[model samples]
Target: MAEKELLRISNLVASFSINGGYYAAVDGVSLQINENEVFAIVGESGCGKSALALSILNLHNKANTKIEGSIYFKGRDILSLGLEELNKIRGRDIGMIFQDPLTALNPLMIIGAQIEESLFYHTGMNIGERKKRSLELLTQVGIQSPELTYHQFPHELSGGMRQRAMIAIALSCKPSLVIADEPTTALDVTIQAQILDLLRRLQKEMKSGIILITHDLGVVAEMADRVAVMYAGQIVETADVNEIFSNPLHPYTKSLFASMPDAYRNARKDQRLPVIEGMVPSLLNMERRGCRFAPRIPWISDAAHEAVPQYHEVKPGHLVLCSCYKNFYLKSIPRRVSSSTLR
Candidate 1:
């Protein structure tokens, strides 16, 4: 059975102006999110994960940000909509749970009022009804004392509690789509698990599509239905969650798995955790042609890469960006792996 498509982003380019020049942070990327599915985008920092999320909501500052893309949400082009027009959909039909609760939440307002703001704007609910719904949302997200938490300001809550409040706000309208950008970044392990569980439960209940942006593959394995491995503003690999875990085709994707401490412990305790050499290129310096990951994996021959890399479908629903993945092997690691054994 086919899942219902909720959002479709086509040739999305989110660029930032630097020194009078615009540099594409999210360059020519496209993907789809379906109803009742969690689509995870995983990559290291500065790989344009957040940029893509911001572009979805048109949240970037227009003065310095150049976004050329069609973000079709429920058949409407979000990029083409004006601020007022976008506002009608921002928190009503689509919601966002931002990374840092401290920064994302308005400190001045109490939690309940913050959630109510969405209800006020989107739903024709009175003050009494909004308050009632706010408390319900707070309780639904696992706040122990909904009444007390409701009146308390964002500064008064713990990191986990603040994150819960953010979740409440995001789900207040029962949106069909939610963009959760690093929802568990600063939390501890136990709290992270709890948060993930809460999100999973809520998503199941709502049956909404989610764009979960994070660098943690562990979170992806646990929560994602589909996964996209991003590298320097482009998707290098994408597949069903099982396929990504079992057979990560892109060299960058394999390198990410190899870097995980658990992968080393599971394979051989003596083996050092493999690290991808070199940082993601600065936006201004990022190569716009060929395989963006080639420089980081210099052992692969130039002939292995396409001048302008395009997606190669290795199997149905599994896509790898370039031919370089076929010949990729970490020079530092003693073992050389074929495509089948890359993971």
Candidate 2:
């Protein structure tokens, strides 16, 4: 049986103006997150992963950012909502676990108050009840000594503990959809595992859909049910997590796998970890037409690329954006070849 859809984003384009003209950070992206599943978006630093996540709730500054298309959450178009209406949905309906705990959490406010802030705005609980709920939330997120942790300020907690506190706050309202953006970014390997585990367990308990935005494919492998690979402000491929790992089709996806350290265990001891050549193009400089990845893949003929490429399913439930992936090769040119040569 198919699970109920929780959120549906259609032809969403989030654009920000450069010096004068605007460029898309999320260009005509469409996706859906089912109830009780994790939909992970993975890409390199400048590939607009974070932009897509923030755009879901219309969180960008309207003064400069121009958002087009619809973001329908539970059948209502979130893009059309006013601030008062959107405020109600931000925490209670859709919670966001921001990447930086230090910046997201208030230094002056006690951790308990921070959690209670969401409760105060969203729920009609009394002060005593709110405090009790806050304590329970801290405990639920795996923080030991919830009472003590509640009284401490955000500055007092360790990096891992602070991140846990952030999780506690996001889940305090028991939102239907949780957007965890790079939740394990700066943490050590051990803490990263713990954080991911906690998110999985909490999602199962709360029965919430999750939009996990991160560059770490390892984390995606551990937690995501499905994955979206983004590059140059557009999603290049999307598939079931197992299928993405086992049978990736996009050239960008293939290049990313080659660059991972764990995928090259059998290589020569002196061989360096592979790298995807060419810096991500500036948003202002991105081509207005054709495949966004065309510049990086020079070996493939121009005819291989569609004038306006769009995702087509290559396997069941797996979509690749470009036809040029048909005969792609990572080693078409020698190692250390320059981007100029590729062009």
Model 2 earns a TM-score of 0.95
Superposed Cα deviation of residue 227, candidate 1 (Å): 0.3
- The per-residue C-alpha lDDT of model 2 at residue 5 equals 94
Clash count, candidate 1: 0
Task: Encode model 2's per-residue lDDT on 10-61: one tens digit a residue.
Answer: 9999999888788899898999899999999999988888999999878888
lDDT of 1 by residue, 1-343 (tens): 6888899999999999999999999998999888999999999999999999999989999999999978898888888898999999999898999999999999999988999999999999999999999999999999999999999999999999999999999999999999999999999989999999999999999999899999988899999999999989999999999999999889999988978877434566566678888789998898888999888888888999998898999998899998888888765665556688767
Question: What is the Cα-based TM-score of model 1?
Answer: 0.95
TM-score, per-candidate, Cα-based: 0.95, 0.95
lDDT of each: 0.92, 0.91
Give me the displacement of residue 331 in model 2, in angstroms: 0.8
Candidate 2 Cα outliers beyond 4 Å, as residue runs: 263-265, 268-270, 332-343
- State how far residue 343 of model 1 sits from its true place (Å): 39
